[model samples]
Target: MVAQRVAVRPEEIRRHNLSRLLRSIHQHGELTRAELTATMGLNRSTIGALVSDLVALGLVTEYVPSGRDRAGRPSHVVAPRADGPYVLAVDLAVERIVTAAVGLGGTVHERRVTTIEGADRLPRAVVDQLAADAEWLAERLPGSQGPVGVGVSIPGTVRRRDGFVDHAPNLNWRAVPFGELLADRMPRRLDVQVGNDADLGAVAEHQRGAAVGCEHLIYLNGSVGVGGGIIADGGQLHGVGGYAGEIGHMTVNPDGPPCHCGSTGCIETYIGEHALLRAAGVTDQHGPQAIAAVFEAAAAGEQRAVDGVHTVAIWLGRSLANLVNCFNPQVIVVGGSLAEVVRLDRVSVETELDRRAMAAARAGVKVLLPGLDQDSALIGAAELAFGTLLASPDSMVASLTTT
Candidate 1:
């Protein structure tokens, strides 16, 4: 028997086209009608109609450049509206939570940050803080009752299917339905999309930051703990249980340090904030500033600080070699606390990686700082918040379905 043929519905086609067009504009920041037509393989009329539809919905704006008038043909440029629909993005690090109202097309409209204290670090307290921040951001949105979506970046393992956080040792959170809890706090039962912070950072970098155009990349994020996100073959490598990229827990030393996860000598134990500080002989200082000061001291050739940085660089390179051998990524982006570590002792780290990594796998890998600086995860959260909107922009006009 022959396979039956069922054509795609016209409405489905329209939704797909609109989704692609909007995403293209979002990715490139701006594009001309002719470029959209060429890139999308759609006719000029179709691109024009889609752009017009998006402009009508206030999701985007199109304008022709004045100087092009001399050429007698000026293609209109399509861009995400600066005042378009927005979403709430939360970056939940171990010590702080950064929240922002991020508009469509990757613009941050308003942001509020709070340091996590002993009591506030608990699940409920975190939820309360996020809920309050959401309310605050909602009040400032443009002509809206709520945001398009909410994206949270957690410094832990998350089961993305249901937004379940399996384990976040740094946050002392375990077996929590964090996504569900945050969703319950929303006014209209808006669903919350939660992801591992490092993973989200990789997404942001792969799309527009350091790893742009690279098919394979790894993002190593250092905070109070280490986390990683891997993009393999242009897609995130999420294993069977969403714990695939937990490289921080990978044991690099069998008898070095005790990790919060009850593991000995995990990579995070060596390169994370606390580890770096302890190595630098700093006792009373904390936060990113203290970490930066350690690097400054190392650069200034302070004996203890220099020794600490060199030690950390060795471990960083060894761990990176392991990843390069396994994934053969084209780019490895060092972010958060580790960014300074890489910047300070790049030569030592490169030497270690060259010694350990297989020649073939090591050939094309480029280790670099995050292109978006400190905002990779935050911007990535914005991308997660926009997922629903990009998938079916029509949902913006209709009431967005709640999960």
Candidate 2:
């Protein structure tokens, strides 16, 4: 006798389709079951069954109308439950530690910032302060759901694969297990993600700021030491070891000055805050004031001041031109505390790039200032936390069919 083949029920396929349909709806926000079915090309019964499962899982809620949908009772709409869970984002900068509680809706519920003068303070003190702030916020959440994850943005090269901080020169840290340390300290069970500050800033820009939809973008972070984040083809290109965007060390001048990285004349030798201060003869004062001093002196037509800005701009422009030739980016965004001082209104740098970069690469590439300024990294860190909860597999599976 020939082997008999078993027939598959239409309901089985419908159930599977229903699950996927609901996930799509949840991803885009509230939608009617009919809209879900139409979008997913599934039958009405499948959507209904899937929605029912979501409702039971407490992952979705129904929006009931008072009356009528074209000669019948109004159809109910479904939306992902807003009260599900939360994530905590910690932005660890050289001078500050900022903590924020974020949700699936990308809303920041609470935030706190603690300042530090130097790296001499205990690392445990910083962690304790951050944890305490998170506790204060957790008390204020509407429901019992705790934070699902924690994301930290550090101002240095972070090896995400092993969750280690290779170096944070600004903060004077080395080989620190930053993520694991925070995870062990927090009261709630949390999955931690550590990333470079500039990289996270680029992510925020891509998601909601200036770099939105651009295929090739470079975010050159002008800070204590210059670093950058690159995005190509709509995704952040974190190289093989997740350290691809370390553009600060790119040599701008081979024999100019010594850099902390033990290199002579790196781009940061000219573009870094220290270089600008020294060029302007205001190395005594630290932080944002030093940058302002350079601008003020330049505005006054002082030779040292004028020379400082011109030299920095020239080096910055040259480095940018080289990057343009290398990456062929659609846009380059300049961000940091100093980005606010000077407007890159006209490109003395673009002239350099025009001379160096390929015609096509130079044609439409825009190098502009970041809209968010220094806050970009903090905001990006919070976004990272917010996305962590929304992008979870459980959240996706729960959105469609609950069972």
Candidate 3:
């Protein structure tokens, strides 16, 4: 076995400490110098030095508390700088594209959403639209440098090594060099990262949404197509080739309807937006809004819509049963177009899970609606971009300054 390499450089050690400090502040929103010293278990002088370095790098700012106790002088609070380095986050959904410029500490500085016309479904068209939207959003940030990184979230499998979208059945894209295409369109040369939307949704939910603090969780997304992400033991489960969370393709009914992935009876065949609308006997020219209307009809006691929701919920619960048995996740969050449907009739889904899943596993799990709503995947993309900078603040700072 090859020996594990260890980092021993003083700069490397300082960078590591800075990363830890940034993560701590980012996770907690803000921290006082005393709080940072206590939480990080570092000496006060070291904590001060780290905070000073972050302040100098323009990553954080030190401010005094608004109200103070009558005891003594209040410690200065360290918070992420509002005008600091930011990342461009894009969510390229089948029906729409949402883009945002997000700052450190999970703050969304600016955002824009554009619906995709049916004619603009090609891979090149999508990439061009995304590049245009990113440019528009970047232009709105006043007195700021360009984004340090860009993260694109797509509804498909992505190769881990280079951000290539291996396949996006919903978008009719196959083995597309999405990162390269988007990078070419960008005005500036910056690292571009791509990830599966569901996987990124899981990361967002685990870090800042409904599944916060959950060591084991499942994030199920419903869009034009269905997808899922799994977090086991506080880590994402990326199987060989980073396609582990393709829960949409799991066989729920071997004899059911066909899927775009060339598989029959997959969970997506029953619960995806198009499938749900078809089952409800509803027809509309628009996409996600049409699905939302169907769920609204179901809530208002429309027979066709109610039946459609019931059928989808039953199938979704059955699929969740399998996932629960496999991962024993602490929570299962349903998001995207299916969120309202799941929220309207949660009992029916739970009853089905109670029947199909193991009693022990079913008892401990909590099924929830998305905390971040439609923004989960976009925020996850931002998290990915922020992660790159936080991991190596010094280098990231240097790159930003030079660029």
The TM-scores of all predictions, comma-separated, are: 0.95, 0.78, 0.95
Whole-model lDDT values for every prediction: 0.88, 0.72, 0.87
Ranking by lDDT: 1, 3, 2
Cα lDDT tens digits for candidate 1, 1-403: 9998999998889999999999999888899998999999999998888998999877888888888435768888898887777889999988889999887667788899998868889999999999899878877774753577889999999998878998999889999999988888886646589999999999999988998999899999987888899999899999999888889899988997899988898998888888888888899998867887998999999999998898889889999999999999999999997898888899989999999999999998999999989889999988988898898888765765333
Cα displacement (Å) at residue 42, model 3: 0.5
Clashes of each: 0, 0, 0
lDDT (C-alpha) at residue 166 in model 3: 86
The parts of candidate 1 lying over 4 Å away from their true place are: 68-70, 142-146, 400-403
- What is the C-alpha lDDT profile of model 3 across 293-382, one tens digit per residue? 888899999999999888888878888898899989899999987787688778888999999999999999999988888888998998
Lowest summed lDDT across 10 adjacent residues in model 1 is found at 394-403
Better of 2 and 3 by TM-score: 3
Write out the backbone clash pairs for model 3: none
Of 1 and 2, the candidate ranking higher by TM-score: 1
**Where does candidate 2 clash, by residue pair?**
none
